[model samples]
Target: MARPAVTLDNYDDVYRYYLDHRQNLLSARIAYAALSARFRPRVHYADGARERLQALLASGTRLIVVANHLTDRDQYTLAATAWQTPLRSVIGRTRVLAKDELFTDPRLRRAIDLMGSIPVFRSQNHGLRAVADAGRRMMDVSAQRLQRGDVLAIFPEGTCNDGDPRRIQRLNTGVGHIAVKARKLGAPPALLALGIAYGPDPSVRGSADVYVGDPVLELPTTPMDITRAVAEQLQAAVDDVRAVR
Candidate 1:
């Protein structure tokens, strides 16, 4: 499979085209159903979190959902729950923030694109200046999508926590930058924190539980502030689920 050519000059257009052309409600629904049937995961939530999420859904408010990066199946778990919950209305319109390498595989790329995924190239592999430039462009695209009333799901930890599922790793400020820039675009998306954990029952196919936190409506002024705020909120939420587990 020939991967899509991505250059800084055309990044925004390419991403918008991918998102516009790939999102499919029917496919998302089917994928959700298939994953749910296969995993039979049990979803949990923080008090009043569901009602808040539902309200946001009803109002059609744009959102940036930040969550822990657990197993490869975490995306499927969230997708299944979203369809089953009030978020069902926004399922087709939500764009997941994913690493660029995930798009290299034809099969994985197809599945995620159908689920409305936007790619982020890791400029850290090149140099600090490159990282800064790439990060800005990525956030610009994210802001554009949010301003257009699209939902975004990102793992602020930037990668899976191989050390411990309950403990959130250090988060980068990319998630914060995206939110701040989106606000500048007049979107000011609501931030929702999520925590996902897999159950221990071997008899059951990895029962996963998702805990939702209240939406962070007040976005901080700086990227560092946003990063710290999200890190604290997500950590608390994940710990909440872990406490019950």
Candidate 2:
């Protein structure tokens, strides 16, 4: 039997309670795992999603899917599968690199921990030490997960952009760091850049399109190369999906 869905009817109270009980985000993870169980996600564009993801995972590529940040709640759609997919599948429980502030909330912190999040610091950029530390931490956590055969999905744009004729900004360096770090371990994971757009024109249905293509660039020796490749693939995917446009 299919599991029943959960509702946040009393979310405000629940949220407050969680905040009072926060403990280094450990409790948050358990709560999140429990809450995540309530959702039953269906892909907006299942057309090639399954096939593409399966093929990439089958190829023994520690997959890192760099998707453009969009407000259609794209990240959650992808994250749902991370904890639910088969062990050998690309969607197997993933470690996300989300903003640090989200963890400050007890309930949110729990969700992040349960979701297996890795805090990506965007502040303290005035010093190189903070930058290096953030990079090293990301490398350690993500690399460990990849070595254990888990995929990592990140939004290079960091946050969603809201506007008509949606826009994607320049790719972030974090994606590149992930690629290079994995490569240095002697088995570089494949970077899958995707462009997800939603529409039905005058009538909005469940219509959506996700165009995927070959890697923009293979694993590189340096982080810069990986970041550039992510940007290239992102543009390519968007074009491939909307080539008819």
Evaluated with TM-score, which candidate comes out highest?
Answer: 1
**Model 2 vs. true fold: TM:** 0.66
For model 1, give the 10-residue run with minimal summed lDDT.
Answer: 1-10
Model 1, 1-245: lDDT tens digits are 23355554456565656545546688887887787777765667777778888888788788988889877777777787676667777877888887777776778888888888887766554455655666677788888888888888898887777897778999988888888888888888888888888876423575777777778778788889989999998998898777776
**TM-scores across all candidates?**
0.88, 0.66
Give per-residue CA lDDT, model 2, range 168-214, as digits (tens): 77666877776776776766787766666655441233334554455
What global local distance difference test value does model 2 have? 0.56
For model 2, name the residue pairs that clash.
28-110, 29-110, 29-114
Question: Which candidate should be chosen as best, given lDDT against the real structure?
Answer: 1
Q: Model 1 reaches what TM-score against the true structure?
A: 0.88
lDDT of each: 0.77, 0.56
Model 1 accuracy (lDDT, Cα): 0.77
